[model samples]
Target: MSESARTHTRQRDDASGATTPAVPGTASFDRLGLPDGILRVLREQGVTVPFPIQAAALPHALAGRDVLGRGRTGSGKTLAFGLGMLARTAGRRAQPKEPLTLVLVPTRELAQQVGEALTPYAEALRLRLATVVGGVSVGRQAAVLRDGAEVVVATPGRLHDLVERRSCRLGRVRIVVLDEADQMCDMGFLPQVTEILDQVRPDGQRMLFSATLDHDVDQLVRDYLRDPAVHSVDPSSGAVSAVDHHVLVVHGPDRYAVTTEIAARDGRVVLFLDTKHGVDQLTRHLRAAGVAAAALHSGKSQPQRTRTLAQFKEGQVTALVATNVAARGLHVDDLDLVVNVDPATDPKDYLHRAGRTARAGRSGTVVTLVLSGQRRETSQVLADAGVTPKVAKVRSGEAELTRITGAKAPSGNPLDGGPVAPRPKNHNAPFRGLGSTKAAQGGSAGRPSRRTTEARKLAEAQRAARVRRGG
Candidate 1:
């Protein structure tokens, strides 16, 4: 191992005077031998210092060695793998339908996010990038691949579909990244992931990063990786010290009302439910109770999901109700609260759900609502996950709720007179130099302008033509 590859550890003395491994420290990215261009981009992003995971993984990865990385969410794993891939493949040109690098994530949201995070750096490196995922126009994604993207960020299933359609070819891939490998397995996409990996060049360097490694992930590593360098920054079962965990025991009848009270609190909050039906139902309930909220799940179309997440991030919507699809690899900035409307059944699920908050050294709180029947199971789950939360028995209108979660009574009024309407399907029309006809005619009624109607029709016609072209 190189001096930079050595894990920097300090000894922590306990009450018995015995030492334990302390959290490791990381050297700067420049010290890891990244190119000046990549370093310049990091500096522009205000990322002068490297996170522990990045420091540990970057050295091996930049050297074209296979790496197995383990780090908790918000540990900067994205940049750890992303920067290495970009730097290694710098100045490489991709052939049509054959990418030079591939990043496989588990969800469409993650694919989009990974793309967004890497785009600026890729631009700085003068590399072309594309994102491929389901729940959107596959033809559009195929067109991007056909135009030749040097790097492709994708989910396994959608990439498989494109490959089958002859829109993508992996023969020239030089480096591959399997981010959130454990979550991909949990979502039952390992088979598709395996199939996709089978197509990549045998000499391509592989990097696999996950919070936990079970039998399935182990199998993938054994089958594909060659003498990988393994680096783990944090324990898989451990909780973030910055997060304050709490279990609120509510009566079954009062759960919905109490949840509404919590959602109405100030600031952006994420509420997790066990099922998509529950997510949609709670979103409606929260909106009805006068909280601006949105739902994110597989049931939502890609456009709808993208819009909802954008609204939440931009503070146009303050609450997001979602299922496990949002549990891993979804990075929201300064989000301080996460509510588990339904307690997670698995220990890893609990950790990932709570991982949404208390990220990047920020203080945050995670509250799990446990009903009477779920108390025992919830306790076991927490214990197994190495979390010892403060258990409280609470109900609606209690001062404890306000003290813990900043819960406040909602002003039972619609948000801007109910939900915001979807944007017009046609967004490419040339702007007319005239004001709305309603305002021009001295009518105060809120209605679509004639120009708006025309734009929509034109957009719809264009969409129909594209569909006919299979693009």
Candidate 2:
């Protein structure tokens, strides 16, 4: 066979026997056996065209068959499963504490995203939806469940906690979808996943979607899914054609400076580190260097994380510093740049971090910084992931950095002539002062800083104005 023919043959052979090929040309939601309400919702969302994964998986899923879908991030896997689950349980009424459909995700962020994505469709169908995740009020979640939520999107840990507390039950679940199954396994949620699956109705339909079907995922498939129609739309590595990858070799001491320059660039940028502490420290360093940046990690409360993400998305913060927790299934639109401040420990992590950009056919650039001590390991990681990026030995404020990442030197002044304060552990506490805890407690030599004095004067003026107007 010719090379092209051989590639086609492999693509045709990747799926299981029960799989059906997707038709070429743009496919519409109406042609895919979806109901009128869902079709209307899709139109309202301006989704007139369906992506490859949705086209391949929707047919079997809508036909009430088990489906194992494999697709990269940002490939419309959420809609692929979400639409099917909603269509299957459209007319069903959920009893208190027992949902008709359950969508399991790997992280709190993903749960929130998926719920937001599906809410309009559920509302159009007159279906009540609830999101259950940890790091928030369980009482609120239980109240929603008690009031009867037909569709529940949740993270496994919080769902399991609710199940154990008898606040939520799985006995009436008619359809279950596991989105991002590979990530759930990576986060050590397989046992909890299996436990939760065991409680669902035995005859319910199941759909599992993942970027890759490794050994652990295969085991879950064997144990839970029955005669599933498998579909693989894109490669698991998430190396989209629109993204350009580069490796920058830098000196140890210059690493932070290079990263700061990149983050200070014009467009929105997401910089990834290996640890939560690294994320916090880098965020502080970037803010101190006059870049508007925010940190997101597991240690942050749910509300703080949400606020940080909103800030980044709304352009209030130009760069977001995060750990691997932000990698999978977190979508931010129009993000053109991603930087790996610390080289990912493995290829999978690298790909997930890079997937944050170049999404949905938008052009993006991903740059990895490698110091002398990490060159060999970084090279091996890239090779294993089948990515061959251009390597350059660069320094801070060099032409190479500018040419590759559009990084320019930043003005030394802080963004607003004020420091970014460290995130408080208690979400209810007000931010007392900028950047310094000691200053917040008491200024140096018992004298307030100029900014604090100005803030007090402004507050007093506002209060006096309000009092005079009222009394």
Candidate 3:
């Protein structure tokens, strides 16, 4: 963790978790006091050494001390807090509708990711962990809660709905975690996140591996976390020096050509667009040009979004065209390139989008195609992010663009319509966006799941039946 580790463990009582005297830590997970079962699981997964954030936070977390841990994306934040929560909830028989541990994330992708990361450990400890996110069947999530689950990983908005329906209870939750606290707040989940936290046990241990511990997340720390043991592994912004940051100046008329060329490059790459409309437009163009592109945004159903990601990861889709939804919590293997087709308006968005690459100590490049009118603003955003990128004026099919991003011309022929999954005919109608307001509730990016419509109708029917039965 040498190159990746710029960490310091501290303890503070103030609202702003700042520097203070050092908190002692160990280098190994076993030495940090993780249970044997968890250590064995880690070993089985070939995870031997602890990341800096994990080393700094696990000691406090395992001891039930509230922890505020901050690290760059892909820095083992899940393991930092998840192991302790699982250990604390182990051997406990949760009553139906009441979980012993709660993990609240900002997105459906993140909830699923955290669940997948923690599953083996929970299984080793004999704990049942449920991931509750919108986009799929609400009845399935409700049934899991209705039966029994020791741990629940969720997105706030859907969790609120479940609570209102009385299908889940937070009263028994003694360990609460907010995975991306800053993103949760930025996405306006603060009220619901706070509401959910308030419902958990008063003395519950809280931990976070946040994107930023600056302004947006301060309220969460002041209100929920007790005089916590805090760890800041990276700088507040989480920008890495190893990443190749580039700002490519492109003329508006040449933008589409440049984008298509990059998408047609020989390797897999993620192309970021600001809006769902733009993402779809570019994806369709790429497919027509035989680029094997897929679109991902909040306007797609959960299953559609899930399938898109699977295709991207499995190499079935060569180009991933997306919006801010995939900016956070989406991890792909060997993904060495990310092209910001539409420059990010905010520094955090830029950082998160750039984070999709350069993960796990690998070399990656972030290229932002800036319009002529966008240079000044994009420069300011980069300055705010503390990154000095390699700036160059690039045009479509130019050698400079090719050198920087491996850009090349696409095939004249169109793909056979297998790159991006075809929209479901019988399920959700082709939503220009993603889910129903009710089923797609929360800060989740895509809005398109017919599964949500069916689930909502089922819930309403169940309630109507309950009213008739007087149960």
Please tell me which predicted candidate would have the highest TM-score against the true structure.
3
Show the lowest summed lDDT stretch of 10 residues, model 3. 423-432
Give the RMSD in angstroms, all C-alphas superposed, for model 3: 14.7
Alpha-carbon lDDT, every model: 0.82, 0.80, 0.84
| lDDT score for candidate 1 against the true structure | 0.82
lDDT of 3 by residue, 272-318 (tens): 88788878877876787778889999999999999999899999999
Which regions of candidate 3 deviate over 4 angstroms? Answer: 1-4, 15-22, 417-471
In candidate 1, how many Å is residue 121 off?
0.7
Clashes found in each candidate (C-alpha, N, C closer than 3 A): 0, 0, 13
**Model 2 ranges off by over 4 Å:** 1-26, 415-471
Model 2 steric clash pairs: none
Predicted candidate 2 versus true structure: per-residue lDDT over 61-144, tens digit per residue: 888878888776677889988998898888889999999999999999999999999998898889999999999999999999
Query: Which wins on TM-score, candidate 1 or candidate 2?
Result: 2
Task: Kindly list the per-residue Cα lDDT of model 1 for residues 177-295, writing each as its tens digit.
Answer: 99999889888998998898889999889999887766769789878887676777667665466689999997755665677778899999999988887788677756766889999
Better of 2 and 3 by TM-score: 3
